[model samples]
Target: MAGLPSAITVYEVGPRDGLQNEAEPVPTAVKAELVRRLLAAGLPVVEATSFVHPRWVPQLADAGELLDTLAGDLGDAARDLPVLVPNERGLDRALERGCRHVAVFGSATETFAQRNLNRSWDQQFAMFAPVVERALAAGADVRAYVSMCFGDPWEGDVDPDRVVETGQRLLAMGATQLSLGDTIGVGTAGQVGDLVRRFVAAGTPVDRLALHFHDTYGQALANVLAGLLAGVTTYDASAGGLGGCPYAESATGNLATEDLLWFCRGLGIDTGVDLDAVVAASAWLADARGRPSPSAVVRALTG
Candidate 1:
């Protein structure tokens, strides 16, 4: 713990990234309540919803409605609700609904980019440039997600240099932060350290980068330790481990918020998140979804 930061920021993504892939449609109210509970659990940044076309992710079709309901409820917390915008149309919808923070997603590999966005790597940057510019012009904070940063389902072992280049471009395009994603959950602790080192060496500030990992390989916490050793503080996690890649069949949930909190707490790293509250929220969500939470911490605590 000597080298690790004493405090870190946990960006909760359960409502948006977690439930989007669920086969069952969670009601808009439930999704809104999930956001509320996550905020109540002391998560500083809770991703509220995505403005992507409903056809692609019908689960979050009520993005606008959810935002409208939480408009007055969020009060001072409204600024922490970051929504996902896949394109110009999504950005427009978000802005119309008074979204002040948004996230754009890109891929480190061309195969996943084409499959996920129907565009090549360079084309995806072109697509995000205007989105970032418009959001910045509207006085909104922008975060960029680079998927498949470690390994790709179609193209294994993505080049770290490519990931660094994408991160640099995203930062140059006005993204206030960059989230490096292990879309397929194939990353190792050593790989994470190496990736962070490469990004920092490429001129990316460590504070401007966050890590998003899936626990498919049971290495999420170990990778987090590596990131901590490398001085990366911000991380993205979902409650109850409630998500998986719809494209990569083997990819499991994002690193669970409860689990991550427990790990950080053990390491004396302050996340400012209530572990029990997050477990309770995940339990409520699990019951609503008619399944046990995939998170080990939730199961142990709730049981």
Candidate 2:
């Protein structure tokens, strides 16, 4: 009920993480335009690209050009343009193109890590060791992702200790923030609060921790409130609620940005974002993808 930010910083990941796992690739122009639309809503952080290899995630290979060519107001409003970097090579390409921030992910479940990264969790951390050092030395802000913190479909329930351990390791390796991802969307409010509680008890800074959830069963917003009460403010959300994990078949779209914004308004927490603009943007992206958005708020607004 306390320790919440007066104004929460919502990181719009629709351009990058939300669209990456789609069965089809979107044009670079469409992606670039989405970035612009997000800024019209005045979101401070927009993760616009993923620097992964083309062979692995061909959807995001245009990352370099997107960063170079994206024009309009987004150029000025986006506080952190974080890109996903799987390794040092990925980091190199991102920095070369004026990327100010980058993110590296490690799963708490070993099996999921092996499937997603083809490496153990520890090795994934090791792969990022030099990447973190290089990024920090280059004056880039680094964010570390601890995925499947609540539970993994493949590995079942994850230990809270392991999640905290990975969070601590990434922070120790110079990551400025940690995003705990519920990759399968199976986390409930109690579980979310417990994980946040344990992470804080483990000496993790509450402000530096973020909650990334999916709404497979429509629990994302409820879980967000639970996190807010637990003193976690930062969140990762996708416009129009478009996303899913290719590695995990049952996964669904991420927590919808509009849905979260609606909740923030009801809670009297300022998000400093324009809801109508976000709905317009989400509608545009949904049309571009040729699918119905997972967001109830966007659906109703655009209906």
Candidate 3:
């Protein structure tokens, strides 16, 4: 009844997630270069850009052009790009740009979902419903993400049952895969395990579930391991562990892809990624940002 895999997939969100919260505006060339370097690092699925309002995320205003332009340039490497598109306009833009896979996000908390989408949970799905239908009809893969799945900045702890309900709603709306995010990175291993177990118990099927964690307290890797044990084979990561929620006051970086690769390789899990290239890319970004990488492996290697 499910299409789960024995191995995991590492979706690199660096181009979109890593650069979104930069204190200074990152040039479009730099963003494109980041995607190029990620492709070189052997990532099969990369979240390239977000097609939301420029006023909300000025960092990704070039989402459409990036898609339009990068399509040809990626060449053989072009097949792995996944863009974050929030609305019908974005889907149209992506379709015009020929994006094969698109990602849309909703949040698990009522308050945060409303704050982000300006729509309640039901309204959010109602909105994404058409986009999902169109993407599927166009033969594009759709990944549905739910932010603040573990916890939210405004809303404290969220109910597991509510999270399952939201996930089910997204799936019922035809979202092929679902990603659960730790928006503020406040989840522990026990909490992460419990949440993943709850979703699995609710018949959400582990294969369709993905984890997006922030290493705010250095626990994201631990959480990833827990998810893998729960039969969740997909996790989202950002290069150099960069990026945080602009709305979340004290949030840190998303879990670094380089570090996660290191962990997976240690456990004999095939990441299909190159650690050296990822480290080099991380180093370059860290130097550009003037911030030490949150990844332990990067810090150790650079030091």
Point out the higher-scoring one by lDDT: 1 or 3: 1
Stronger candidate by lDDT (1 vs 2): 1
Give one digit per residue, the lDDT tens place, for model 1 in 1-303: 589899999999989999989997799888888888988889999998899888888888898888888886877556558999999999999888778899998998999889889899999999999999999999999999999999987888899999999889999999999999998789999999999999988888899999999998899999999999999999999999988766667677999999999999999999888999999999998988889999999999988
Question: Each prediction's Cα lDDT score?
Answer: 0.91, 0.87, 0.83
Could you give me the TM-score of model 3 versus the true structure?
Answer: 0.93
Q: How well is each residue in 21-82 modelled by candidate 3, as lDDT tens digits? A: 87777877777777888888888888888888889888888887676556667763454588
TM-score winner among the candidates?
1
Checking candidate 1 for backbone clashes, the offending pairs are none
| Candidate 1 wrong stretches, greater than 4 Å | none
List ranges where model 2 is wrong by over 4 Å.
1-5, 71-80
Q: What is the number of backbone collisions in each predicted candidate, taken in the order shown?
A: 0, 0, 0
- Ranking by lDDT, best first? 1, 2, 3
Model 1 lDDT on a 0 to 1 scale: 0.91
Write the residue-wise lDDT of candidate 2 on 239-289 in tens digits: 988888877887888999999999899888998999999999989888888
